[model samples]
Target: MAALRDAVGRYGIWSAELHTVSPGERGEAAARLEALGYGAVWFGGSPGVEDAAPLVEGATGITVATGILSIWQHTPAEAGARFLELEAAHPGRFLLGIGASHAKLAAQYERPYSAMVEYLDGLDAAGVPASRVVLAALGPKMLRLSRDRAGGAHPYLVTPEHTAEARGILGEAPLLAPDLKVVLETDPGLARSAAREHFARYLELPNYTNNFLRIGFTEDDIAGGGSDRLVDAVYAWGDDARVRDRIDAFLAAGADHVALQIVRGGTPTGLPADEWRRLAAVLGL
Candidate 1:
């Protein structure tokens, strides 16, 4: 827990990438990113915790994490093996971010929380140290479970406010790391356009929609992409200083680490290499 806490204190700027760098180039990209000073990389999209190793190899020492791996789609044995392998390769630089994926979407979502607990129990029984992992939590129920069962929660698609709420729920100890979306372009309308278009898919997912509604977004705000207010709040855009300011907002609100996702293309929020370099420069890491 102390190591996890130390990680949070040190990993001030983490970069999030939905599209993984191809194997041929991933390692190189990661090395460059590490050389650039980004402390960690948050990866997503269903490869389970197994994805950590290859990407970790990409960067010499930067921490590589699954933004989340649905606990339903894989077993603890497999994840445990991969977890150990990566840990052997990089030690403290690999963090496994796991989740009880939404019941509406996961292949096996029965007793979601309980299933996750069971999964964790198996991991423990199989010898996967709990400190090496985190839960993708949002609401209080999961947040509390995250505190008790594993290291902490890695909440996605949330604002600084949610980080504050999660911090309160998890209390003073569990790590509270939240991901924030960003569009580096100076154009508000364009950045919001990219954000809204990219966010429409998640809006239909009841869990995220429900969370947004609870967070004060109107039905209109959730409809047809997203309202300007919703887009601006969720996606930190404008200048380097502005985005850094938003990161500060999350930190002040109690987030230990903020994963910054750069939205480059409208279709998949592509993060161009040059763009990543630019951000890395401004972040001073």
Candidate 2:
């Protein structure tokens, strides 16, 4: 846990477009993130560990995580081999974040809990230590597994209240890192619009909807691209002070760290570099 904490501090970025960034520019972006003092960079969109090694090699003194690499896509042997290779080149600077992604996203997705258990077993056999991995867990069963087997849990699209409930379940052992969506705009209408644009696609996913239900969002709240209350609860929107307050609330709710995914006004792939800098200043990091 100490090593994990040292690698990913209190805040980081979970970007879907990071891997898509041009190779030449990706390293520069990573370097800029390090200079801005973000503790970690999470490459989402189900990247393989191989896709992340170049980013690790590109930057210094910052943790690089998968946000989650889907179990169905990468075999445990391949993942473990890549982990070792990356670790050899950059020790204590890479975190393996694995998940049982949505059913619709993978053709072989079935018995996810069992599959994740088996996957972890294979990783163990392949020499990837439990401390080097984190599970993208949402339910109690997976969260317990995260504590018992992996370094911790990395839950996505969660609220502060969910953070508190997850902490209670984890009981202070495993690391609890949740993804928090943020819209930098101060205007309520514009912020919610941005949030909806980022969230509408997710509403169709049962895994996320089920988790939202567990966290107390009603079916109505989940419908129509999510209700205002739902969006407000899930996103940290507004100016720097308001966003910082939201981050503080999550921390106070027992989050070990929060990985913020900034939802910019236009394309989510636009890369909100300026907003990242603003958040760094607010977080004093």
Candidate 3:
């Protein structure tokens, strides 16, 4: 667990668009992220181990991880084999993040917990060590599994309060890296709007809404593209200082690392390299 935390460091970048580009472009961007001083680069959008391989190859020092590879998409044998290949090539630089995903997205997403256990079992049979893997866990049960089975939990759409609870369950050892959305805009209206635009889709997912409800957000807070309070709590917006403060809150609440996902208005595609640079400056990465 200490090795995992040190490998990922205190901060990392999570991007859905990073996986949409060509292999050469992706590699170059990954190298730039390492140059910018980010500890890890998480390949978002349900990426496979193969998707993160180029990032591991491109960045010599930065840890490259799957924000989450859905268990339904790839067999554990296939994932484990690919993981081993990347490990042999890059050694400690690769971390495998796996998840059950949402029922809406996966046609076979029934009995998620049991299925996750089975997937981990298969990975074990395929010789993928639990220490090299992390689980995209949300609730207590899965969080417990993350502590007992994998190296840690990589929770998405979570708050610092959730981080505190997860850390309690993990007992100060397993990595607790949560994905945090950031909008660099300063205007309250603009920042909340951008956050709502990015958060709209997630609100439709029951898994997220359920988690939100569990974490104390009311139905009204979840309605109409989320309330301002909900938006502010879940996203780090306003200015550099505010962003840093929100990220620090997570650390204070007991997160090993925070994975920042930049949310820009208009279309949520293309790499936000400038934003990443600005964030690196603000974070003193």
RMSD of each: 2.2, 1.1, 0.8
Q: How many clashes does each candidate structure show, in the order listed?
A: 3, 0, 0
lDDT of each: 0.77, 0.89, 0.93
TM-scores for every candidate against the unseen true structure: 0.92, 0.97, 0.99
Cα displacement (Å) at residue 120, model 3? 0.4
Assess candidate 2 and give its lDDT: 0.89
The model with the greater TM-score, 2 or 3, is: 3
Better of 1 and 2 by TM-score: 2
User: Which lDDT tens digits does candidate 3 get at residues 70-104?
Assistant: 99999999999999988888889999999999988
Off by more than 4 A, model 2: none
Best by TM-score: 3
To one decimal, what is the Cα RMSD in angstroms of model 1 from the true structure? 2.2
Model 3 vs truth, CA RMSD:
0.8
Q: Which ranking of candidates, highest TM-score first? A: 3, 2, 1
TM-score of candidate 2 to 2 decimals: 0.97
Off by over 4 Å in 1: 8-20, 267-271
